[model samples]
Target chain A: MTIEGQGAVPGLTARIFAGHAGPIAVVVLAIVVIWYAGAVYMNAPRQMDVFKRANADWGAVDLIEGTWAQDRPILPAPHQILAELKKTIIDQKVTSKRSLVFHTWVTLSSTLLGFATGAVLGIVLAVGIVHVGTLEKSLMPWIISSQTIPILAIAPMVVVVLGAIGLKGLVPKALISTYLCFFPVTIGMVKGLRSPDPLQMDLMSTYSASPWQTFWKLRWPASLPFLFTSLKVAVAISLVGAIVGELPTGAQGGLGARLLAGSYYGQTIQIWSALFTAAALAAAMVVLVGVVERVVVRAMGGRP
Target chain B: MTPSPVQSGPAGSDGDSVVRAHGLTLSFQTADGPVHALSDIDLEIGRGEFVSLIGPSGCGKTTLLRAIADLEQPTGGNLSVNGVPAHEARLARGYGYVFQAPALYPWRTIERNVTLPLEIMGMAAGARREKARDYLELVNLSGFEKKFPWQLSGGMQQRASIARALCFDPDLLLMDEPFGALDEIVRDHLNEQLLQLWAKTQKTVVFVTHSIPEAVFLSTKIVVMSPRPGRIIDVIEADFPRERSLDIRETPEFLEVAHRVREGLRAGHSYDD
Candidate 1:
């Protein structure tokens, strides 16, 4: 029997499109619809209250319109945040502290620095734990317990203590990111480094391969998939760490400072814009990591 | 003490055994109790001999091969390879082993995979590449050198593993059911290739398998073993000429040897129930 969809050209196109892009588009559309509805629902009561105090005769259309375009509503509409984004990210000079691009760069620098440092630290620890039985037994429990303490609880303390030692700005923020990001890397790398099959290990023994050779030839390459998976999580968490670090210090630059400033001034639109920008930034960084993982894994003979 | 002059070994040669084990025993300490993997295993593999160990499940054929390769530690008994203890033999890289699976590193090209042992031994880059090329060609995988392991079929992967095991020019090759996972056609084809490879290389091989015909077809000596203490019960010799083809399996002499091997296996298996 012939496959039903094999030779149907239009059906193939539709199926391919529907397989991925279609679901994403539908989900996005649904989110926007819900968001607009929520914006109207949350903002209308305040607008009606204002109208009642002014003894104004307003219809439902006027109330809905008024609520949607409020200057300081509790929840900003999607278009309002988009307008804010365009103003800060596009209209302003990137060098200006007010520009979101400037803030993003500040946050991004710390994220990359923290991610790099954390990844290196994690891999070194993993290697130690895998190769050294004493380290695995001694350091593993400590490493696991390190993540149990909340990053938020520790972020402020880390900032304050590091500040006392004359460390400020990017280094302190990055250190916080390092703390948040290192756990995943350490955990993932441990699993990855131990991922080689018993038979492969036996083969190495047959060849009289040294621990160093076995590591370089077999364990490292095999662990790459696990390392990359951890890297994605680490990078995203790094961004969060940077943002959180900025909060306690009340830093003069970066997305976290923007969020703080917006909150102090009751600029709901600004807050919403900064929050969305942070989200988009996280998504972009994760995708970037995913791209690198694909390249490395494929080069290592994994299926594309 | 040195091994006694035990001429009763079914496949013993004229004092040139590459692998010699006397009263070898290995047991594992599991949660329940000590499990005897191999008990009182006495084996001697002569130079350039192709020996097959055949047994049912739980048999210590693979363990015996591993013990010879120094991958297992025997609780008792004396075992030697290349006139030295098994550990020393391993440290000298005296043998190459092919596992049940291909075990090729996915990251490396087929040539690089073949050169793994050479690289570990710190061979010169040029020599390693040249040797890889020669062996890949020997395995009929020359053009596929730059390709990865996953790019090949299961049969091709196993052949590449064989090339890897041979590229180091070891005098002994220990194979653990190398073709057990392949389909019947592929297994038959591989068996033929392996026999030809053995004839060409003249390396002593100790192969582990459970297939009766496979043991009969490729082995100069067939070792029939039993499980649950995993002891060898019988050894049968089939002294076919080196250049003989697969057609020999149909001959009366071949069938007679096969029949004997089957009988030995049956005799050993009777104790299982």
Candidate 2:
């Protein structure tokens, strides 16, 4: 069928334009403008200081020759970070042992493992809570309370405890991610399991269907939207947990370690680059969940 | 228990009474106390008969149908269908039951909704498809099979529900105010369609409705029920011809039966009060 004849294409296109295009354009424009303005303002003083320092120290290579490139103690310019990103990704062997890519891969692995573990545990717990009223009434409040304890404060203890037992590398990081990722999944699943309408439940009862059948046919399908929503939240939290886990372990790899080293040595450009990488990773994880949601719901005969 | 009044009719050659209830009493445990929904109710419906249980809102007509459908248990007395207990009859010989509202599942397509009972009965896939198609055509919803329930209008949904009920070709059909929510024009059209359906299927139908003309137009027998502690007050045998039309409402014979049903209703209320 022709796209217009299908009765959905125009509306879909309009929605994309209205909801996404405008905000994205505006945000992109604002960020570019702000970055350039900040670059000019910050670089003026830094360039003068660099010129002075280079003239005193070595020669004009630091002052008049590539002097603008040479001198920030912290808060490096956008161009500097971009140059570093290109050098690390292309010129330098980033995928090798010494590169940032290897560390990023390590962090990504722990984050994914932790997220999967947490999501499965959370979903199981949610199913149990939904089926058992006592668990729902008693355990829900405690789960909520568990989130209040800061991961930053707990990370050191976790690292120490695991280290004492000679458990290191990815386990502690994955556990932290699991801890952060599970809460949203539990809450979302509980809401989803309870989402079936009274009439739908009554229909199942009229069929003399067992509770298990009802759950399989009705409750599970109804929970899909909520499950995906929780997945998005859990993925972001999983990244946070992985980052926190890296903080106390004195780990030499991963974005968290890069962030720590950059801060300690006053390499602001490295820190910002790592932060951006983490943000991109989290975005990628959420996008992956969105893709899975689309595939699943479509398989279940829903119009995604 | 008091015996039901004699049916006073020549026995049909087939000798199949589709439904028979003896001294049926139904009570629900409400917060206040035990509420007698139905009491000492005795009814018998013959094969190919169309009967309407006409009563006020709370007169337990729907409750009686539910009991007959094995969806509810009678507090006392025996209810049988086709020579067996209602529950057993329901399991062995399935009965089509249409609730007051169109209880079509929202998630299912109209075709799937019609085939639900067939699926439940474990009918073969090919036969189920053919039967669903036939019933959708019966309800004049031939082109809308693939549409979801929410996409249809209320009248269309009700039609789909009726189609679903008839999909299994059950000998007995119990409808609870099937068209009470429709507009007058739609109700008249549906009544004609329903009579046509009855003519074709020749199934025993026990329908619950409050409309006097509806009961008079559709039913071979009108069981007028009373409220409070609900009980049958009158049973009117409609003398209207078998092949009825919407124009039957203008006839004197139809008017006489309508008058009788109304009087039965009034007398039922007065007797209760």
Candidate 3:
């Protein structure tokens, strides 16, 4: 019995090239090259403007070197961001308000709170939607449309309304994060809960299992893979929400405040560092979710 | 529409009948129109009897099995299992059903999948594990209890599904093409094992299949069904010895029953729908 087109198990180099480091390295190199070019291009005009004002004889090389070395480049080079990160993150005391670590912690606390809330709410709503048809029809559409209104537009309102209610700081920001991240969890959970095919459903019915038993034994476990995949998406967006929530408050804490503070003071390096910190925070959160997903899905008897 | 008159099954005490469906009918309201899945599916499966429903695609053999298992409700006629309503029988844990596909929860170990019904029925954890192990061993899948379904071959997974169905020890076992997806060699091996399991346990099995040799070789009575209105065409009782093997399929007696089943199938079909 000959089965054609069955590819052999890839050797080490082929496996790496096909799925691991090879494509990643290429894409990262391309992005870095583009970043360097963009940094030089944007910063050159400022550098040239300074040279022109001083009436200095500056060539293209001088302008390039000047732009690259600037303490306040409009768009920081990747290396400049890296250097700024090391200076703020490693050199400064973690307790210092100037430290990126201090700012990141403020934002992350709210992000985690929001993410946990969203996860719980999503699962509950999903269960309801799966079991109760009315919720699926009524709440699902509203949940979907809730995301269409820009978080940036709603952030200030939420913060102000909560402030009016005498609630401040973390709760409002966490609410924003919850607002942003809950949709995917809700949608993904609904999809996951309904993931079982008809035969599984029939099997459950044949067992004379109750709806609750059917859910735990069949539906819930079946939905796990879907839940984890959505959690990855939700966790990253939750970071975005927490940062956005921080923006309207102008609170002297959080990476978003740091970015705003840099913008007001013309400290582009500070702004770039804050941006980089937020990016790193999002990555770390997503990676954490990925690790948890691998553990949970594998423990649930699936190939992770 | 000339389905054979209701033929009585082999004589048995009233208490011996695990499933008794009289004039069972089921229909679905589709976008196109009404589709009849089963009509007047009269069947009485006695205690320890192995009955196979054999027919072509869309012939309602699976439908009849599902109806007996209480997975489908008859829109037009009466259906009973264990001399009670199908749904009531289901609530009483009257039968365990095996589908065409393995349908094992991929997220559960083979043992856990087997223990799910037991768990649902509120059996103690220790008892569930013990029963799961015993059934897994019965299916010749003892060592693989800790493994996931995808880690096993198609045949082994189906066997594990069988073990899962049998673990709860329902009086009746409704199997819908349990080995339909396996290769011929694997199907033959499973058929032999299934017969042995049936003999040892003496559980009444209502099997659905499309294979003539499978029906002839394994069934105490073969119910031939057809598609137009989805009703039974003929019910042929076999007198094959209780102690049987895959080699029995090669004998003249098996061929004679297979020929009658084939003829019944032809008689039930019309050139036009």
Candidate 4:
């Protein structure tokens, strides 16, 4: 049978363009233009200082070209950052400290470890808050207050305390990410676990299902969509947490270490490359979560 | 204030009543005050009877059904289901409840939704699937077993919910306006289908509805109720034949019963104070 709206290629193409691709292209172009402009603007003074040292005269065109190609720009151009990323991630050996991939692996390990701990902790807390009234009354305010304390301020203390006890390397960093990751999962899961309407609750009571049975059959699957959404947000912040945890410790490896070394020597291009790599890593983690969400929601008979 | 006369129950029913409530009263403790939902409700629903509790909005029809299902405890009453207290009966899996909305889990297929209670009861997977299939076929939803709740229409979703409720084959079914959301045509169709299913299964059903014609068409006994401090106004024996169709609604006896129900509702409003 011929379907009127189904398999309408031109309409589908138009919709995809209108909904996603066109807007993405416009925003990306705008960001690139602003970034290139910022690079030239920020690097112009440093380049001019060099020219002045040589007692040489220059114009805007020279400043623009020199700024884009500077060995150590104050703010690297987008193309320069991209080139550095390719060199560090693609050309350099995976085992080399200079390779961004190696640094990413070091950072990613802590992020994943912290994320897993945080996710489990958050779910357990959420379950506790949901099932136990006293926990809900006492814990929610404290959980919110904990987030208000800046991670940057807490990271050093955590590192030092752990270091004093001879706990070094990954644990401190993973703890920070774990700290960052658990809140959203807890809050989102609470909302999801309570999502079933009054009528649904009444139906469950009629079946005389135990609280455990109700959670598995009704609450958990219902909470999954919310959990995944929170996880996407949590995973992104987890990468940030790892990097911050690494920053205070001055670890000899990881992206955060690379950033610290760059800043110490005023190698702005190196700093920018590390920052961009971190952002890309975070995006990849979020996308990974999104893929898992689709697979799980579909497995549970949702439309994905 | 004049005393409201108490009606015992319908005659001509056999020995056992699935549900027996004596002066069942439920009140909610709201911020404003205690809101009396069901007051002095003495209802007896015998075995294999299709009883409909018809009332105005906020008249405790749903509350009464909920009490029967053991979802809510009556504030002051002696309520029993299957000769045991409501709570015990619930724990014994004595009844299946169909809510006002379909309440089907969006993440489960139609077949899976039907099998959920069975899974909860720790039935074997093979047995659960068999029972689900049988009930789905009974509800005329066999082809759509793999379809999710959202994929179906409102009527289809409600039917799937009914199948889920019946898959476990509970001796009693408590329905809270199961088709109140459906349009006229679908409601009529489901009403007819439910009657047929009732005849076939011999399960005692306590259905709550706002529609008089619906109550008349589906119920063996019609309970007319009124609002503020909700109480039953009249209990009328419908005495309609088990083997019948929607066309029976046009008959004189049906009209007489419906007329009595309307009068009971009008009489309820007379004592609104």
Each model's RMSD to truth, in Å? 4.4, 6.4, 5.7, 4.3
lDDT of 3 by residue, B76-145 (tens): 7777788899889988888888999999888889999999889888999999999998999999998997
Instruction: State in Å the error of residue B155, model 1.
Output: 1.0
Candidate 3 local lDDT, A188-282, one digit each (tens): 98999999999989888877889988988889988988898888889889989998998887998998899889899888888988887888888
| Displacement of the residue A208 alpha carbon in candidate 4, Å | 1.1
TM-score of chain A of 2: 0.85
Instruction: Sort the candidates on DockQ, descending order.
Output: 1, 4, 3, 2
Off by over 4 Å in 3: A1-30, B1-5, B12-15
Off by over 4 Å in 4: A1-23, A57-60, B1-5, B9-13, B270-273
Worst 10 residues of 3 chain A by lDDT: A3-12
Candidate 1 vs candidate 3: the DockQ winner is 1
Ranked candidates (lDDT, high to low): 4, 1, 3, 2
Instruction: List lDDT for all candidates, in order.
Output: 0.89, 0.81, 0.87, 0.90
Model 1 chain B worst lDDT window (10 residues): B1-10
Best by DockQ: 1
- Candidate 2 lDDT, A138-248, residue by residue in tens: 998899998999889998898889989998979999999998999999999999989987645655554555677778767887898899999999999899899889988
Q: Tell me which residue pairs clash in candidate 4.
A: none
DockQ of model 3 vs. true complex: 0.65
Q: Candidate 2 on B81-150: residue-level lDDT in tens? A: 8779988876664577776678776566888888876775668989988998999999999989788877
